[model samples]
Target: MTTPFGLSSTATTNTLVLGQKDLEIIQPPDDAISCLKFSPLSIPQTYLIASSWANDIRCWEIQSNGQSVAKAIQKHDAPILSCCWSEDGSKVFTAGCDKTAKMWDLQANTFVQIAAHDQPIRTIHYIQRPSYSCVMTGSWDRTVKFWDTRQATPLKQLALSERIYAADVFGPMAVITTADRNIQVYSLDQGPTEYKKIESLLKYQHRCVSIFTDKSKNPNGFAVGSIEGRVAIMYVETANPSVDNFTFKCHRSTPQPPTNTQDIFAVNDIAFHPIHGTLATVGSDGRYSFWDKDDRTKLKTSDVIND
Candidate 1:
């Protein structure tokens, strides 16, 4: 996988390889990579997190040249499905099949189990604020909850009919997607207790897999990826009516894969380049493709991760 926000092109057929100029192999593991992230402010240093079906989350430090340069950074008791770093890069947030989300303080080297959802936590994002920051989590319970990092109790919660597939916060808004094939925008204006639904639509009839805000590009524009392997770009304008203000445009998917690559892949997650609007996509088939948000064109591709 392309380092979370870093850049790499791999050409591995069965092995994860760094592809632009030539082929380079990434270390092979017994388990598949469940999630990946790049270190904040760390250039060319990326973390590859793998979760085993047996309930294990393993972290590997990868160099720009496609080598697993260090030992696993950490481990968890249950199968980890999602992982994210604090906005300041000081801590890490993780969710697993254990039905709980944990906060890890790198400075303290301690892990604290925070809250237990009704089901496994699927996605999470840490919001950075000048005064205080918070972490938001999405679970299979069909609800999304916000938790204050300094406190263990949930600050607020919102319910939905279908299980939540993805959730992330941007500025004062949190965007959530559910199995109902709809994306709901919730406002944190009055804290979670009085959440006002800002937007609701079935942008994708298929399960929405990833949602990300392009704060670096346009403050109000964000993107979402789906199980059908399609992506929709949206712009959130709060000036409009309550839930009818935002407008979204579905970008056409790249042309079908070459006949030989029919089984090519699907997107796992999308993260905007910290400095630019370029998008990094990790495919289930293991190909890490990069696209320019402005033009929505493929910029680069990497080898498939070993599953």
Candidate 2:
């Protein structure tokens, strides 16, 4: 069978699902994937990096014809929890249960430990600015640290209300969620000070978050997902009565013939489209959905995946 992208199912064992236009990698991680990110748009080639519970990170270059070629692999002593690519797409950073974060340089082909925490690192993000560039890491240690990567110690560290659960950074804005249901917004322009602190709108534990821009492409607000199968669209400035925040239910299955209750699955991750500003979410129900946040409507929902 031949795919629309010119890939054949029988030609290579590295690819799969010819009819649906899905192509599986040759050898995936042994355990569950913790995080995945693509290279910055400035990069000409499409490169993907994935971290896993198998205690390793893998990179692949996706070709123009839909073929995927293995590029690089790096390892940690413990399971990795998060990973991100540098703004220039020249480097990758990963954090994990090993209590440390590592930087992988694609040009030099070197992997080195760049930061450490008292407890397992939960999430990491790369922040690039005109004056400086740094990696921001959140940990179960109840703190967020900013690292220069070249230094042995962090340049700045801020205490949080509780252990970090999820976080995201876009431009100069950063949003962090903790185990105690606290959400703190930060303006990196002010040197990492707390800009606003609020409780999560969801009733359960925070699972994921992503910062998004408004029509002007300015950092306006963010979307948060929770274990209760709900998501909240939040604005940085709630003082304006015209801009409102809202929550909605998703990743839930309909009741069967005999039962009146639905099965609710945790929302695992949320991402914003770079060009369109639309939102995308993936849940434990093995389904993904796209939404127009501005209109408060669901654009599309995918069928549940078997795998």
Candidate 3:
């Protein structure tokens, strides 16, 4: 199929007739999954790594024969709260409630761990470039730290006023959300002194954050999730930055609200497809939705995940 943007791709999507979801199975640790991410397309085989509250991280490799093998890697002293892969997929970064971060070298079978913070680390992000290769971590200690692969400890840290909940870096921009309903967008230009933080007009506590979709290696903006079932799309660079940003309510009760009240649920996750501008979201209410932010259209909405 070809989109109006001249992008083409192949897919095998079936028409979902009922509210039930497409065939799937539940598989993972005995504890809750804190983070899950698929490997980059540059890798030969597709694999998924999931971090858990059990202090163990697991990986699943899909074989050519359609079978899959899973492996558990344990090292964290406390619950593993978040995980992310290096841009090249050579290493995986994980942070946990143990107040530490660790790097797992997949091929070398070696791991390096370090004390990351005084409080539990909530998020981890990897941005690897020829000139700059570093891992960024956000924690409940109310700070964001940057770790260089060449150093044994973090080289720089950015302090904020609230507990960090989620973070993501795309190209030269980074967006981070916190429990205080603040969304901080940073400029990843040069050194620590050159970094800039943008002001946010959000009013609800944020849950997740993700950069916008782009195949040309540049992102226009990012989306922020809140506990009130709202997603805010914010642009970093624009003629009128405030006017370019917007928010919408979603994944809540379909029927009318009660007299003088409204139903509220947390937006669990938000991800943008690389080839298309389609934004997919999951909510604590067990409902999922697909939206085209470019066109302001709701593509799909289904109550497939029962609470």
The per-model lDDT (C-alpha) reads 0.61, 0.88, 0.76
TM-score of 3: 0.85
lDDT of 3: 0.76
Residue range 228-266, candidate 3, lDDT tens digits: 888888876779876778888887775664565656788
lDDT (tens digit, per residue) of candidate 2 on 1-307: 5432233333334556535777887567999999999889988889888999999998877777777766768899999999999998989999999999999988777899999999999999999877778999999999999999889999999999899999999888999999998999998875677899866678899999999997788898899999988999988876852458889899999877776789999999999998898999999999999998888999999888776
Error of 3 at 153 (Å): 2.0
Which segments of model 1 are wrong by more than 4 Å? 1-29, 42-54, 60-68, 71-73, 149-152, 188-218, 238-265, 300-307
Best-fitting candidate, scored by lDDT: 2
Off by over 4 Å in 2: 1-14, 240-243, 257-259
Could you estimate the TM-score for every candidate? 0.70, 0.92, 0.85
When summed lDDT is taken over every stretch of 10 residues in candidate 1, the lowest stretch is: 244-253
lDDT of 1: 0.61
Full candidate order by lDDT, most accurate first: 2, 3, 1
Q: Give candidate 3 regions above 4 Å deviation.
A: 1-27, 63-67, 192-195, 213-215, 256-262
Q: Rank the candidates by TM-score, best first.
A: 2, 3, 1
Candidate 1's displacement at residue 67, Å, is 5.3
